[model samples]
Target: MALPRVSALRASVRAQLSAQCYHRTFHGSSARTGRNRASVLVAGGAALVAGLIAGASRIQRAEMTGARVPTALDGKDLESRCSCFMAPPVTPLEGLRSPDMKSRMELLIMETQAEVCRALAEVDGGASFIVDRWQREEGGGGISCVLQDGKVFEKAGVNVSVVHGFLSEESIRQMKSRGKSLKTKDGKLPFSAMGVSSVIHPKNPHVPTIHFNYRYFEIEEADGNKQWWFGGGTDLTPTYLNQEDIVHFHQTLKEACDQHSPTFYPKFKKWCDDYFFIKHRGESRGVGGIFFDDLDSPSKEELFKFVQSCAKAVVPCYVPIVEKHKNDSFTPEEKLWQQLRRGRYVEFNLVYDRGTKFGLATPGSRIESILMSLPLTARWEYMYTPPANSKEGEILKVLREPKDWVH
Candidate 1:
C-alpha cells in the first residue's frame, strides 16, 4: 500500500466543505447585511479548520493501522491480485494497467525479485529469506529480503525499491553530468527511481559473489515535461578465478545482450570494466560483466524488453555456478583470501560506487538496503600480498587485467 497523501486529502475535504458553504451563500438573501457576510466568513474558516482536523485524524488512523486509506485518487480504480508478488505493487494498479513504463518496470522488478529469491531458496535447500515491506514517507516504498547464514550462502539480499520524490540539487547536478538538461523550480524537481538489486555471497569461496541491478528512472521538470531512462548491469566478483564459470557467466550476459543488439554486449562490457575500476589499487572490482547507464536511446519499449531479457538471464547466469561449487573444499587460507576480496568489494561500493553515494545523499534512504551489498564479513590487511605462484595471486592478476571471458 502507498503512503496516504494528506495534501490531497486536505484538498478534497476543502473542496467539499467550500462547496457547501458557497451553496448556502448563493441561496441566501441578495442584499445580506455586512454582519451576515462576516458570519459567513467565520463559518468558512471553522469549516477549513474542521477539514484539517479530519484529514489529520485519517492520517493518524492510517499510521496506527499500518495501512493507507483508499481514496478516490488512489486505490479505487486500481486492480492488483497477484499473490505471488513480493509486495503490493508500488505504483497504483490502475496506472500499471496502462502502457505506462513506470508501472511496467515496477511489475518487472517485482517478478524478478520473486523469481530470484525462490531460485536462491531452492539452492539453499532450507534457509528462507526474511522479507520486510517498507514505505518511504516522501513517496513510495520497497520490499527487502535477506537470508543470512544460509546453508549455501553466507549472506544474500534481494531488494526491490520504488521511490518517487523531489531530487536534491546535487542529484540533479550528477544527472546533468550525464548530459540530461534538467531544469528545476525552487531548486527541486520531481523524480522517481525504481529497481531490483541483489547481492549473493556464497559460503563457499569457489562459488563466488554475484551482484546485479536493473532500474528505470524518471525526472520531471517544472514545465510538466519528463525524461526517462533505463540503467542496469550484471557482474561477477570471484574470490578465485574459475575460467569455465567466468566464461559461462559472461556468455549468458552476452546472449542476453546479443538478443538486443551486437553492440550492447561489447559496449556495456567495456562500460562495466571502466565503471568498476578501483583507481587507487589499479584493479577492476572483479572480472567485468556488463554495465550501462543513462540509456534513453533506441526506444523505450525496446530498452525495456532489453532490460527484461538481462534480468531474466540472471538465474541461468549464476545458479549453475553456485550449484556446481557450493560444497567445494577449501583451506582456511583460501577463506581468508575470500575475505580479502570481500574487503575490496566493500571498498568499491563505499568509496567509488555512484549508487552508494546517491543512496546515502537521498532523503529517507534505507541504510540497511543501501549497504546490503557488503558481505557479512571482510578483512583489510596492510599491504597484503599473495605468493606470485598461488591461485590468490592469479585472481589478483585477473582483476588487474580483465579478460574477454565470453570470447
Candidate 2:
C-alpha cells in the first residue's frame, strides 16, 4: 500500500486551518540567559511573540531569505502562505538523482548548500565545518550538510530529514523521551518507538555553526486516537570571535521574528542555545540561532506560519557568509585539527546527545543517515594542548562557560 505523502498531509492541514476561526496568544518567560540571570520578561499576549533576552560574548554572524510575510497573523491568507513559504521546492528531490528517499533529500540539500557554501567561501576567504553521524537502532535514516564558510555567514544550511514509518506510536515515544517526556495512556506508561535519518553541520568558522531539523512524530492510543506533528528549525554556533557575524545572524532572525512577533527572535534564540547545549560539557554547541519543536500549538495553521518565518530566515542569514569563506586556503594541519575537533562532536552525539539516544531506541530506524553528520574523516590526539591564554585558548575558555553570544 502507498503511504501518505507529507505534502498531502500539509494540504489537508492547510484546508482545515483555512476553514477555522483561529486566534492565539503566546505568554511565557524568556529563555535562561547566560549572564544577567534575571532579564527574563513576560511579553504581551501575541502568540506570535514570546519574550526572552539572553547574553553575549564572542562569535560570528550570517543570514538567509525565502518566504513572504503577512501583515497580520489574523489574515485569511495566512495558512496558504505559511505552508507555501517553508516547504522545500520539490525540484531538489528530482535533482538529487538518487534512489533512496533519504539519500535523495540529503544529496539535494547538500547540493543546494554546497553551491551556497562555495559562493560564501569565495567571499570570506575560507571557512570551517563540523560533521558527525549516528546509527539508529530502528529503520530508515538521513545525513546533514551545514555550511558556514563565508563572510556573510556565521553558519547556515537546510536540514534534510528522511524517515519512513515515522508515524508509528513507538516512534513518537522515542521523540518525547528525547525532550525528557514520556508517553502515557489510561494512566499507565506505554511502549516507546521511532525511526529516522537526519543531519546538521555548518561550513564556516567565522559565522559560527548552526542547526536545523524537520521531523515527523506520532502517538497511537489503545482506543485508536492517532496523532502526529512536523517539527524543526535552524540555530547558531561559533568558534572564533566575530561580533559582526553574531549581530548579522541575530538581526536577520529578528526580521523574521518581527514579522510574526517582536518577542520571537529573542525567545527562540535563547531557546536555541538552551536546546542545543551539551549538558555534560557545560557549553553550547555554538553561538545561537532559532529553534522550535512540537510546534503543533494553538492551531496547525498558526504553527505553520511560525515555521515558515523561520524557514525564510535561513537563506538571508547564511548564504552571504558561505560566499565569503569557502575558498580560503588552510594548512593540512588546520584541516586535520578541524577533523580532530569533529572527534569531540562525534563523542557528544554518541555519548550524550538526546537525539542519538532517541534515534537508537526507535524501531525501523536507519543507521547510516542518522550518523551522517560525522566527517568523512576525524582524529584524536593524546592530551592535546592549547597555548596558554592564546586566542585558541580563549575560545576554549568561553566554550567551557556557555557565554552569551550577543549582548
What TM-score against the true fold does each predicted structure earn?
Answer: 0.80, 0.56
What C-alpha lDDT, on a 0 to 100 scale, does residue 303 get in candidate 2? 50
Error of 2 at 184 (Å): 7.5
* Tens-digit lDDT string for candidate 1 (1-407): 12123334334423432232111111111232431111111111111112112112111111111122222323322322223344456665556665477876786787677667766877888765666566788888887777888899999888999999998777778788878898789899999999999999998888889999999999889898989999999999999988888888888788778877999999999999999999989999999899999899899878988888788778777877787888789999989999999999999999999888888878888898999999999999999999988999998899888788776
Superposed model 2: Cα runs more than 4 Å off: 1-208, 226-230, 331-333, 403-407
Every candidate's CA RMSD = 17.2, 17.5
Model 1 whole-model lDDT (C-alpha atoms): 0.74
